[model samples]
Target: MGKVYIVGAGPGDPDLITVKGLKCIEKADVILYDRLVNKELLSYAKSEADLIYCGKLPNYHTMKQETINTFLIKYAKKGKVVTRLKGGDPFVFGRGGEEAEALAKQSIPFEIIPGISAGIAAPAYAGIPVTHRDASASFAIVTGHRKEDAEEEVKWENLAKGVDTLAVYMGVSNLPYICEQLIKYGKEKSTPAAIIERGTTSMQRTVTGTLGTIVEVAKKEQIQNPSMIVIGEVVRFREKIHWFEKQAENAYPVSGVL
Candidate 1:
């Protein structure tokens, strides 16, 4: 039986992929990649490699998780090296854990190759540090996408009172709800917040505001999914250290809420 490699493709930048992740792509006989993965990275795959698209959209799935696991097992049993390339870290909201569990049940041989998650990379590219020496000392990565009835799954009170910083993924659609929860749980309405869209890529854009006005700012700016929502005092540092946007030829001016 051949081995399987679950690799994180990093955020949106092709260059952000780890060296080991790249090597997995180069050596794989079959590659299943996700939607958020940078297509440019596929260039490294061997010419004879079989490329498969497993991209998924918000509220839509192009390929089901069961099918993906089946494919991995099918390829590996055929003695073909398989690479499951996903955006950000495989285990961080990428469903890599489920895939690993599936493989484990079947006693498949596989390696986990971690990639930089957007939670940290996106904020850094936006010049918003997840943790700051003076402004922040605690950090949390949250999934903003939740079922209507599962709102209580996240500990809003602890996040508001205990955490110093929060990086929310897939949150653009639920911005208002997120802000409301934080505020309702003791977070200051004036707490700084910023959203980085398509972060780490050339098309990245950042919008800043306070918890009280971020939802409105997001609506006016028309920010969409695949964006990172950062909340903390560290957001204030963006103005002084905002470097990546400076390099983008078409970077938008940072919109701030008064």
Candidate 2:
């Protein structure tokens, strides 16, 4: 029986894919990719490989998780080298663990290849370090989205008052709620925060403001998902660095803090 490979395709930049992850794409007989994965990477696949789209948007799924698992099992059982390519590290909110568990239960041989998660890469490309020697020494990655009306399990108190920096994923839709929680739970309303939209790509856009004003800034900027929210003093560094935006300016020439 052929084995299954669950691989990370990195954030958005096609070049950021790890060597091993790229190899999986090249050798796979069937590739199931997510919405956020860079389409450019598909060029590396073998001539006859079958590419499947399994992308999901907020509250909408093109392919159900169970269907994906069934495909992995069915293809592997047929002796096909199957690759499940997801955006970002498969284990880091990419549902890699669930897929792995399904494979394990079926006794299917599989390998997991990790990729660069946007939590760090997004901020880096935006010139904001998640952790700095003086401004920040501790960092936390938290999910910005949750089931509708779901109980809030995230420790906002600790995250607000304890963590030195926070890299929030998929939190743009709930920006107001996130800001209010942090401030209500002990974070300073004046704390600096920034959003890096479509980060690590030529289309990257960044907006910076205090916790109290970021919601308005995001609204005005029309920043959308596939974005990262970086909070803490580390965000202050963007004014000094922000090299990617500068590079983008040379190529795309955007206006005003994007």
Candidate 3:
């Protein structure tokens, strides 16, 4: 049986892909890629490599998770080197763990390749460090999307009181709810916050405000998903060191602070 490599394609910028991840793409016989993956990486694949699209939108799935698992097994059973390329780290909200479990159940040979997640990368590119010596000492990566049927709610209380920095993913749509939870759980309403949209790419945009004002700022900017919501004092650094946006020729104009 051939081996399977679950690879992270990084956050948008093709150059950010790891050397090992690039090698897997270069040698794979079959590649299943997600929507958020930069298409430019596909150029590294062998000419005969089979490419399949498995991108999913919010509330819409182009390819079901079960179907993806089936394809991985099918390709590996055929003795073809299979590469599953996903955006960011496969384990971070990428549903890569579920895929790994499926492979494990079947005793399929597989390897996990971690990639740079947007949570950290986005904030950094925006010149907002998730953790800093003076501004922050604790950090947390959270999902903005929560299932209504989830057995337990996210521990917003701890996050508000314990964490110094929060990098929230897939949260543009639920911005108001997130802000409400944080404030309701002891977080200061004036806590600094910022949204880095389409971070790390040429099209990145950044907007900043307090927890109580960011919702309106985001709405005014028409920020969309694939954004990182950063909450902490570190966000104040963006004005001084936001180097990427200054260098990005195509970056969107910065929105005014509230």
Candidate 4:
């Protein structure tokens, strides 16, 4: 019987991919990938692998999600090993659950290989910690693109005010409105905030400021998506306790999680 693997490609850098995920890609006969996935990581796939783009990019959606599910089931039924290569951990805002659910109905055997989520990795690459000893103790990872925007408005506000830190994935477009909502819901204007563009890759750029100004700052800096937004007192730690500056070989975990 053929098998399917839902693999995380890490934030962007090829080397950041988990060894297990790389091995799966190397063996895959069909590779279905997301928008933000780095091409370097695709090199792990077999030379003859059927590479399919299965994401909605800036304006192009080579294959919609439902089609991707159908595509996976189709190829899997052909007794070919398939890989759904995604950016970040498949379970973390990756919509991996939906694909997995669809696969289950088709009785497709599958495995999930987790990778470093952009919610944590991007901030780390930008020298920000989701949690800090004195600054923050808890964080919420929210997707900028939610199923229900208005319904989620209050919830996002609650999270903004309640959670020690807020990391918004794919949130670059909604920054202005989100910050406005948070400020209206009693979040402090001076709350430290940052926007990291194309994190964990050579193209990574981080812009830091207060919640009140980061929107304008990011626009001025021309920071784009495929990024992470971190907002909290913990954002201040970037000045001192940073470690993931890409010294040489590996990305060392930063200190002071306590």
Clashing residue pairs in candidate 1 are none
Q: How high is the CA lDDT of each candidate model? A: 0.94, 0.93, 0.91, 0.86
> TM-score for all predictions?
0.95, 0.95, 0.94, 0.90
Q: Give per-residue CA lDDT, model 1, range 27-62, as digits (tens).
A: 999999999999999999999999999999988999
Better model by TM-score, 1 or 4?
1
Question: Ten-residue segment with the worst summed lDDT in candidate 1?
Answer: 146-155
Q: Candidate 3, after superposition: displacement of residue 151 in Å?
A: 6.6
**What is candidate 2's lDDT per residue for 1-258, written digit by digit as tens?**
989999999999999999999999999999999999999999999999999999999779999999999999999999999999999999999999999999999999999999999999999999999989989989999998755543573577678888999999989999999999899988888999999999898888999999999999999999998899999999999889889889877876667875
TM for candidate 4 is 0.90
- Where does model 1 exceed 4 Å of error? 148-154, 250-258
